[model samples]
Target chain A: MSPVNLSNNKIKLSEVDQSMKWAGLLFIISATLWLLAGTALGMISSYKMHNSNFLANLEWLTFGRIRSAHLNAVIYGWCNNAIFAVGLWIMARLARTKVRHLGLLIIAGIFWNIAVTIGIIGILTGHMTSVEWLEIPTYITPLLAISYCLIGVWGIIVFRDRQSEHIYISQWYILGALFWFPWIYSVAQIMILFEPARGTVQSLTNWWFAHNFLGLWLTPMGLAAAYYFIPKVIGRPIHSYYLSFLGFWTLALFYSWAGVHHLIGGPVPAWAVSLGITASVMMVIPVLVAAINHHMTVLGHFREVIESPTLRFVVFGALSYTLVSFIGSTMSLRSVNEISHFTHLTVGHAHHGVYAFFTMIMFGSIYFILPRLIHREWPSKILITCHFWFAALGITIMIVALHVGGWLQGLAMNNPELLFIDVMKGTIPWLKARTVSGFFLAIAHIAFAINVFWIVLSVKNKPAVIGTKALFTSPHAK
Target chain B: MDWYYYILTGFVLAGLIFISAVYAFHWALKNGQLKDLEKGASSIFDDDEPLGEQTDYSLSKSNYNLHTTTANESSKFIQ
Candidate 1:
């Protein structure tokens, strides 16, 4: 901690950020493009739910294909790209290592996007695999896997080259995610798609992959960002290191088994279903641990949460993680699953986890990261505020509408005397409300995209040197 | 036959994960990585970005100036 060493550390950290600049921007820019595309498709699908003939004439835009395309575009195209960008940068910074082999990383990123582009087109054109999370066609998946491996390798490389001997909590999460994704992904593909598991085994494998895709992959990456950003922004240590240790290990142990609960009342064996429910219920331990840690850390820093755009979005995401996880555990119960299964309630729950929790954290990470990468402050605070409110309010409306409508639909469906047509008809108003929410989400996304492009393209201010007093005292701060 | 395949695959995958995790936990414990929890928690911050200083905020002129003045005072005190 000598002055010279402190200065050198600053310079080294600056170097780490500099190395990630272009690759991070590439991933984020591509992620935004996918987000806009997914939003458009989501709007169409939501409309078609209420009005079947909204685009019935177009084969490619049929409801099934469009809906599946929307899911893949958001999860694979938007979420994964954002994870690569934010996750890798965080890993490199915590490891205090400069990301090497920039050319390979950028090339792999381009190929990854290309594969996603092909996969989306395939899904739209009716070549989709019809699997829930693995809708991308089999032919395109190998390319996706290969490119992902190339990109993911850099995380391990950065870890291997880390200057720090003590691995931070965030590093553990990122590393776990980077390794877990490909393992689950490849196994699911081989079992469900390539060899085609027999009978109920295929369904089992499919649910296993689908659930783990959220539980193991996206959840870890999202938590990694929360763990790092929450403490980093507020200038405080995590509430309890012991709690984080307990949380991480328990999540790792329980989450993988919890996915089987998706098949609660299906043809699966009673023992397997019971195991899933048990694991799901046990998830409350980690969820509570994380909730207490995050809430306590930010308890006195509420003012900072309001003032800092990054902290606001991340804190919202962290709170949603707790809410969504608890809801998920409840839904896994056979009694609750009986009502929620195959209903729009499940759809609302999915968005609650993906958009409200994971995507919000990614947005916050982008807000914090972009200034450091570009060496310039965001051009407009109004746009950031608009983006946050519209997104928050829009998702809130959509989840409420869907959950209420879905519960009514579920109740009606369970009644043998009720006509199926009437049950379907009852959901129209809720579907329309969802379309309206989609419109709000679209506006939020457009505002975000506009702000990003404006800041990137503008040359109004001189670049502030990072890791120096100038960064804090720039005359053109805003 | 299908049940056998399912059981074998499930057990193998689960066993691999369990073993790997236990090994990792053991390694961490043996390496003293878990010895100093306090230092580990504060390790993400550096002298330049020390503990108890807000480094990011929504862009605004007044807030920016306030933060800059605080940072200047902190730096002078450190010197």
Candidate 2:
């Protein structure tokens, strides 16, 4: 708060950014490559859904393997890499500490990506484990765990060496996720893959791991970005510190328990199913708390949200978090899960959480962080706008088509009088719509990738040529 | 093979979460982290990236000058 402290803080912040530069750039660039790869595979998978013969000739491109590969590429490849770039940078900044041992971190990052590459290759090459989220082959799994441990440990070390006496809310979320991921990932690996749990316990553990990976690992990191950027961009504090505290703890407590709801209607016991359902429903408390906090902080910043690219993407993600979490809670109910479970609706819901909420927030964070990390402005505004609209519109169409088609499909299937062919026939149109939506997403990602590389390749310290107006000019300057 | 596998897995996972959560909460309370809600909320902002200042936007010639000035000033620290 003091003048000298402020100056010192600025220097510290710069130091933090400098420390993250090479490693952060490496993570982000790798993430972009994976994003393109994953999106292409996703398009192929979507097309195969409607027209099965599109890639029927290739054994590795078989629908099942391709779909699993796409999932891993996006999850482990794109999302994790982006998380490393954005999440770690944020952690370093909030902790007010310089990230030391950049070489180790970079090596960990490289190994993590290498492991993912090998895992995706293994999945496609008939070495997949057949487990839902653990499709990556058993041999490659330990490398991933080890690489992740190396990367995740850096976050903890940063926290341990933090200069700030009062821990910020973002730090809490990042720290919690840093700790939670390894525990869940390793446990899932040991129980479900390495040791091989018996019978239905395997399925139960599979769902537990898969859901917690999303809920605990990805969700927290995404929320951490949203919490930090929304307020930081608008130049305001979060609406209520108490609400953030409540949101975080509640999410931690309930989300881990809610994974079992995925096994409803399975061989899992009634009590376990009930516990999952209860936990899933109880998740509303945290979701609502976060929604209120985020929306309230951005209450009158509509103009800023429009002007600042970072605010725009982050705000969109923050809104989607509210929407997706509520939908997820609703879907967890026995009545709803019975309808939505196996239908394309669940697929839509997954994208709603992962792509719309988590991915969008990451996009926004990159927009903010890259400028500081690289000390170069984004090369083009048109590209950023193009990227936002395409991504936003694409995911919107995908979610609607899948949810509506899936609900209808679910309804028709439940009515046994309806012929099975009719149910399958009804889904083709929706699947085709999904394929169409994939094109929009593809274009969006392309635009984003172009902009990232453009800035990276552009001369540093050069003035931006795209727009003339300052989006975040000082109040006095205006 | 047995039902206790379920219980054991459940208890262990749940216990880890519970113990960790309690520890975090206790540490937070002891460190006075929960006391000053307002200050903690505003802790993210500083003079360089001060509150109410939109620091990032799509770059343009008009804003480019402003950005570069900040860049120049901040560049000193990097060296």
Best by lDDT: 1
Q: Please provide, for model 1 over A191-267, each residue's C-alpha lDDT reduced to its tens digit, 9 standing for 90 to 100.
A: 88887778687888888889999999999999999999898787677888778988999999999888889898889
**Candidate No. with top DockQ:** 1
Error of 2 at A283 (Å): 0.4
Clashing residue pair totals per candidate (backbone < 3 A): 0, 1
Indicate the fraction of true inter-chain contacts that candidate 2 also forms: 0.41
DockQ of 1: 0.35
The residue pairs in collision within model 2 are A235-B52
Per-residue alpha-carbon lDDT of candidate 2 for residues A18-114, written as tens digits (9 for 90 to 100): 7889999999999999999999999999999988899799999999999999999999999999999999999999878777878889999999999
Chain A fold similarity by TM-score, each prediction:
0.96, 0.96
- Supply the TM-score for candidate 2: 0.92
* Model 2: interface root-mean-square deviation in Å: 7.7
TM-scores for all predictions: 0.94, 0.92
Worst 10 residues of 2 chain A by lDDT: A469-478
